[model samples]
Target chain A: MKQLVIHPERCTGCMQCELACSFVQTGTFQPSVSVIKVHVFDEQASMAPYTCFQCEEAWCMTACPVNAITIDNVIGAKVVLSEVCVGCKLCTIACPFGTIFYNPESNKAFKCNLCGGDPACAHACPTAAIEYEDSETKDWVGPWAERLNESFLTALAGEPS
Target chain B: MIAGWVGKVLKVDLSARTHEVQELNLRWARDFIGGRGLGARYLYELLQDPTIDPLSPDNVLIFATGPLTGTNASCGARYMVVTKGALTNCITTSNSGGHFGPELKFAGYDLLIVAGRAASPVYLWLCDGEVELRDASGVWGKGVWDTDDMLREEVGVPDARIASIGQAGENLVRFAAVMNDKHRAAGRSGVGAVMGSKNLKAVVVKGSGSIPVADQASFLRSQWKKKASLRDSKGRQNFTQLGTSSTLMPINAIGALPTHNFLQTVFDGAEKISGERINDDYVVAHKACFACTIACGRVSKISDEAGGRFLLHTSPRNWKMAGEGPEYESMFGFGPEVGVDDPEAIIAAHWLCNDYGMDPISAGATIGAAFELSQEGVLNGTEGVLEWGDAGKMLQLLEDTAFRRGLGDEIAEGSKRMGEKFGRPGVAMVSKGQEFAAYDGRAMQGRGLSYATSNRGACHLKAEVLRADYKDPGHEGKAGQVARTENQISALDSSGLCLFLNSGATYDDYIAEFNSATGMDLSMDDFVTAGERIWNLERLFNLRAGITPADDTLPKRMLEDPIPTGPRKGMVSKLGEMLPEYYDLRGWPEGIPSQEKLAELGLEAIA
Candidate 1:
């Protein structure tokens, strides 16, 4: 299966991925509406494009009362059925990654659907920081978070790593 | 409504503490395009009394975003700060790239025009669709980095982009820069000083709105295509890898890098402080502005030992190991121009300028002039402090200048004023009271011509002639080329695209993007004509500000003094031969625009 992979180290914080993702989500260019977000760490001089990981045990899909959230068999992306969504707050609360967002304009929950398997963000990213490829499903956020925490801990201890 | 442009102008009066939203004038928008040109149009109308003091309450300050700003167009992160420059007393249009510009558009404003002075220090906060003036007492005297952190925390919007000034601006340093995103700056002609005079500390913005285009499909297609071209472009690759610091050695090789305040053309220390060296030793990561395909910003870290050598009194927040810059201009200003080759000091000083919110070019150039003055026994009270290649004193001067302390008070007035005060106007390497960029005019004749006539004064970005001048380096037939290139660049600047895009894309690409985004069909000639209009408008503003046609010339040193050593030794700028031809090409006989030419550019009604 083709999965979305994010290499946070390669991101330049240009926000082109967000711009492209928003254009796919909403017709107009709006970062606020974009499913993908680039979290900037100015102190560390790093940026990471983060979104839904489509975990096999997807909490958002389980939390959906209206059965509006389901996984695509081919791409493994948990897709949101806006037509059937009740605009509940449960899925947002259940999601561990906090990638799922409530669209006030549409009154529907939205997350990265990988742009129907041809992700706009992966295509738009200039540095190839975000990629959609056939790879083993892995924990992208855990490694990035560990690296960030390791740096923070090193700085706190006043020791060179 | 124009699709690309937000079509809303926010007018704020600091004295009255009132604000109003006005519709953007479509006719002027078409003529000026946007950003620098659009801001010029509004400023020309609002600031009718061009002779007013730039630092006075009467002067108007405008922050304008181009039509392409906030769009997915490649390198769409630019905003123009147009006002009467406190340094030059001439109309200045300073451009900067970062998220600030796109955020302003997302906040639903195309331009923010500030008029009058506040009774107390204040910062403008634009959130969602509401504009408010907040008391800035807490962050009033803070450095830009601190101000950014404080304002973001105060506004409770961590992601909000902030453009602010530091102590340099608060003290009204003549060459103070308005820094955005903490590191990027609208960094020329004392726009920050003008903001300081208005008692404005910062402009903090958080936006959530969308920018709808006239043709979404076409805009996406054009942007993607441009990005693909940039991917293959050698210029883009060089810029991405080296981030402009690469130009230091080449310009030095051509004997164009002004060393020790234009006394020499080449620097022996160029290789030590070159871009390659910085990339090899200091660079930790590459960064970029909004939607920028060319990730040319260098995020570098100085070692604890190397950083400790500078001993700058900066906040702990700014003492972080990694920061952006030491761009080519700053590298030259803080490097060869001052005869310093210590890359670590250069990086440290670059951070000092950013934290202090100052233009490194003017600060270093002023120090350069002071060095010569002290050397020649023309300056007093500076026995050992103003010596060349002294990195410690250089950093000390930067802090002092920002705080307006002791000798820094005089240095803060800029080199032209400082030199004239010392009874040696010829010592300053400035044109129209603004310091020259890295390139020495003597080695690049067309660059000299551009420097002399740039409306904002001694700016290299106003025209594109570096490649041509590098090839020929002569005065012959440069008049027409400079004139034509200036028009094209003026148009490009107003369109809200990065000038660096010229590396991969053509004028036709910009025009196509503009047409698709704004729903306005303009040919290449029409686009250039709009630029021509913008140039003339700025010229008229400068003239009315009492800058005479005679002021359209280079400094005395550039014209008479041959480069003392290296590749272009014995070379002097032939500005005398080029100026008249340029004037004729500009349809400005005697350097005043002809009535017929004004009519042709649709400026007759105003001129």
Candidate 2:
């Protein structure tokens, strides 16, 4: 499974992620439509983007009395169905991360659905701060290589190749 | 059904605390395009009082958004404030990019026209379709940052964008700007002073709305294509990495950088305060305005020499010493132009300008003039106020100017006035009362011509033909280029697009996007003609304001003094050679637009 990994420090707070997400989800270019929220902390000169974590036992899914929220088997995303949604405030209150947002325009609750495994935000980010990485991939620079082979190549290059 | 417009405007009377929604003038909209052009048209038409004072409540302030503003258009994050500037006493159209413009557009209005004086300090709170003037007494006399912080809590939405003035505006500092998103500013003219005069502290807005475009699908595709192009652009990349300070080293190398009150062409301390050094030493992070792909905004933290001098600086993030800027202009203004090399102090001064709500370029240039006067001993009235290389004194003067204290009072009137007050009119490095930005006009012919002809006095962004001006060895064909570029820039500025984005997008791309967003079948001639019409209208406004053809001139220093050092040595502004050609190209009767030219550009009524 690939997951969106966000390094907030690397983010320029351009909100390209929000715009990309909004266009994919709502067929519009509104920041409020985007599931991903970039909270600006101007005084500190920092910005942190927040989105649904897809908790193992999703609070929004469990708290939905109308059964509008459900987990997708393919992507493990806790998705919201606007048709089934009653615009109830319960799921929003139950969510711990405050990632689940209710849209006034649609009168439904919505959160990040990972764009069905190909999130537009990760693709749109100019800095690659938001990356759709294979979860199993190890944290290393350049292409992954075995330690002995990498050491041999590094030795051959006479520098950290 | 113009696709991009919200189709309405809010006309607010501060005196009555009342607002009325009216249908946007379609004829005017069709003619002016939007933003600066549209705003200028509104100001020119609506301002009926013959003897309206700039700081008086009669002088209207128009906050307008372009058709592409708040749309998915690349760099479509700008809004402009148009008014008669208190500093320059000319038609001032100040442009700024941030969340505010987009938010204003999202709040369902194309323009906000503010007029009349309030009985007390108040702020306009706008949400969706609702608008009201709320009491701002608590936020009164506060810095821009503090006001924004308090207002957000009051509004109970952290995401709401606020544009506010600081102590400088409250004190009616002539060069005060309306600071938005904390640091992003319409930071050139004295628009803030007009706001102050009206007793309006800020405008708070939050919009949970979507833009209804002509065709969403095609618009999205167009935006995507543009974004892809921007991603690959080399200029965009350099801007993101180096910020506007990217030009600092190059200009310094060419001897075009304004140094020591425009006396020297090159600076001894230029390298110390150069972009490379600042980027390496201080820039801790990068940020951006709303929807900006090129995140040229810098976040720098400076630890004063003896540890933290500014503790918990009351910034939004509550950082001890973090702020946006010391961008190229402010850096030059406070650094080499004032003969100071302290980058940290420049950053500190930049932070002060943001907080206090003043244009750093004008303020710093004004201070540079003061320093020059102090050195000459001709400043009998104001002595011992400033000295060369005195970063500490410059900071003090900045604060004083914001607060309207002592010699800071003199500095607040700007360089032109400050120079005269001290008995040296020749020392003032200004064009038509406003201080010029970085770049020696002598070394850059186009800049000299642009400065002289700029409607809003001595602004570089009016038509920054820096490359053509800098590299061109002679003054041939410069006038036509400057005039054409100025008209183009005027058109571009009227659109809710950043001129910086022109690096990646071509003129055709701009035309396509404008046509796409507006659903208007505007040909290239129509677009360019509209720009010419808008430029002429602005000129008419300035002309009506009593600025004559004689006012079209470079500063004495640029016209008389030769470049003393660096690449373009002994070169002076050959404005005399270019002025005639420029007038001819503009179809102007001796610098004043001819009636035939005005009618050709569809300004027959005004003509």
Candidate 3:
């Protein structure tokens, strides 16, 4: 399933994503409405982008009293259904990541739905900090270490392989 | 109905001790947009008499917010403080990015128009729709940070935001700045002095309401995408990493970083005072305004080189504070401008300016001018007080100037006035009575022309040609480039977006955001045209104030003195060569706009 992934180191803390999200979801520019948040640690000279982790055993999906939340099969994104949402805010409390939020204007719970399999946040990102990738197909780590190990082995074999 | 707009105008008359509230004129809001543009329109309407003293009760200070401010938009926490400039004696509008703007929006007011004079020192407090004028006698004499803290305590709300002045403004320093959020400031054009003139101490705001937008869903979605884009942008990277000081090396490399009071183009110790050095030496923490995703602000400190044998070490003033910046200009102004390449000295001077409440640009320029005069034996009786590269003496001068003490009294009046007093008016390096920012116009002709012709005088942020020229410095297409950039920048400033956003977004992107927010069918042409109209209006204001075509020229030094070294060696700004072309492109005859063009811009009657 396609999942939204972030390379936090690449984040510049511009908050263009927050603006984009708030504009799309609420039709106004308000950071409170943004699902994705960028927290900056100035002392360290770094910025980290946080969003819905989209866990396998999602606490929000199971905690919804009226079953208002559902997981999308194509993108593995947990989405909120306004029609089913009773504004109970149970999912917001249940979610450990605090990504799921209740919109005061709509009185309904809202979370990242991965923008229908083509997330606008990723699309608009100038630095390609965020990407939508097939979690199962793509190797998330170890490539660099593997390449280094292979090079060391080739050196031991006395060949430029 | 934009979510953030309060749709109201708050008017206060200090002389009468009266206040009134009025509905914001939707027509004006839609046409002029907001912030600087709206404030300009209001100022034009209110101040018909061109001779009104900038510090008099007759003068007006208007704080205005655009349609985008307080919205969910990125970097939308901007507001304009508009008044007659104490520095230039012309139209001065300074914008600051902080929670104060957003809080003002939440208070359900689009604009705060303060007019007339107060009987005594007072402050205006606004809580949502509740407004009152209270005595500020106790905090009147305090510095910006102290006043802010006192006001916050008095209001008993830690979240309450305050914009106040310091000793410089109280002493009527021509280049005083209006500080807010402890460090952020409406930091140019002497807005603070104007406030001090009115006997107003501070404007405190506490807002707890939300801004309503036309479409919540769409705005949220767009905001998210914009956030992501900005988070990854190269501009954002540079800003986040090095703050605005990132421009130091590039500008220095291009010989645009003004050195030695702009008498030289190259600084041999540029790297020592560069952004990388700042990051490595004294960046204590990164700071950001409320809702700002791009945390470009730095709260830095330097304590390594204290108690040293320096001119300023008459008393050990150990420096440790988290001020907003030593942005590229400040670094240049406090660093090479005075021939002091020490980063510690630069940071100390920066700290003193913030603590004492002075505009770094004006202060630095004045000191630079003084250093030059001293070097030439022009200031013979000053007792070696004005030495180049003497950081301690610089700090001492800054203190004296802020308080208008002895020699400080002369320097406090700004370089233009001081230079005239010293019988070297031509060497003062000012236009419209305001001092130059950090860019040496000799290196970049376009920037030189921009500085010469800028309504507020010698200000780079007013209109920058360096960004355009960075790609092609020698391009003759610079006139059009300046015009286009000036127009768009005017629009953006009016729209309440941070100018830094221009690094990642174009006019089209801004227009898109504007259309989505206001639901106005504004085209790219309309947007640019509005900027043109705004520019013309400012020009008309200056002309009405008796500033003529002759005033639209570079400093004699910038025009005649060729840079001694660097890539721009032997180069002088050809402002005279470019002015006519620039004037023609601006739809003006010679250096002044024609009556026909004025009429087309709805400025004929005013002119």
Which numbered prediction scores highest in DockQ against the true structure? 1
Comparing 2 with 3 on TM-score, the higher-scoring candidate is 2
Model 2 - which docking category?
acceptable
lDDT of 2 by residue, B56-162 (tens): 98899989999888876778889999999998888999999988998888788889999999999999999998898999999998888889889999999888998
Report clash pairs, candidate 1: none
Give per-residue CA lDDT, model 1, range A1-161, as digits (tens): 88788998999999999999988877888998888999999978989998998887799999999999988887778999989999996899999989999987778998989888899999999989998887744555567679989998888899655
Docking verdict class for candidate 1:
high
Could you give candidate 2's per-residue lDDT for residues A1-161 as a string of tens digits? 66677777778887878878887876666787788988777666778777886766688988999999988888877899889999997899999889899877788888899899999888778778788877754332223236547877778899544
Cα lDDT for residue B223, candidate 3:
65
What is the full ranking by TM-score, best candidate first? Answer: 1, 2, 3
lDDT of 3 by residue, A16-83 (tens): 57656665665445555678887754334466667886777789989999999997776667889889
TM-score of 3: 0.82
Task: Pull out the clashing pairs in model 2.
Answer: A43-B316, A43-B317, A44-B317
DockQ of all predictions against the true structure, Cα-based: 0.83, 0.47, 0.12
Q: Identify the runs in model 1 with alpha carbons over 4 angstroms from their true place.
A: A138-161, B313-316, B382-385
Deviation in Å, model 2, residue B391 alpha carbon:
0.9
How do the residues B1-607 of candidate 3 rate in per-residue lDDT, one tens digit apiece? 5334668899999999888999887776776778988898889888988668898889999999888888756777789998889888888889898778877877778899999989999999998778899999898777776787789899998758788888888888988888876567787889988988998888999875556666555555566667667776888877877888888888888777788788787788899898998888878666556556676877676654452433234311323334457777789879888888888778777766765678888998898888887777778755485767888778778878888987788888889899989988865878778887777777777777788778777778767577776655563777777788788778889887888776555565677677777777789889888888888888878877777888887777888888888877888877777888889988898778888888777767767
Q: Chain B TM-score for each model?
A: 0.99, 0.97, 0.96
Ranking by DockQ: 1, 2, 3
Top candidate, metric TM-score:
1
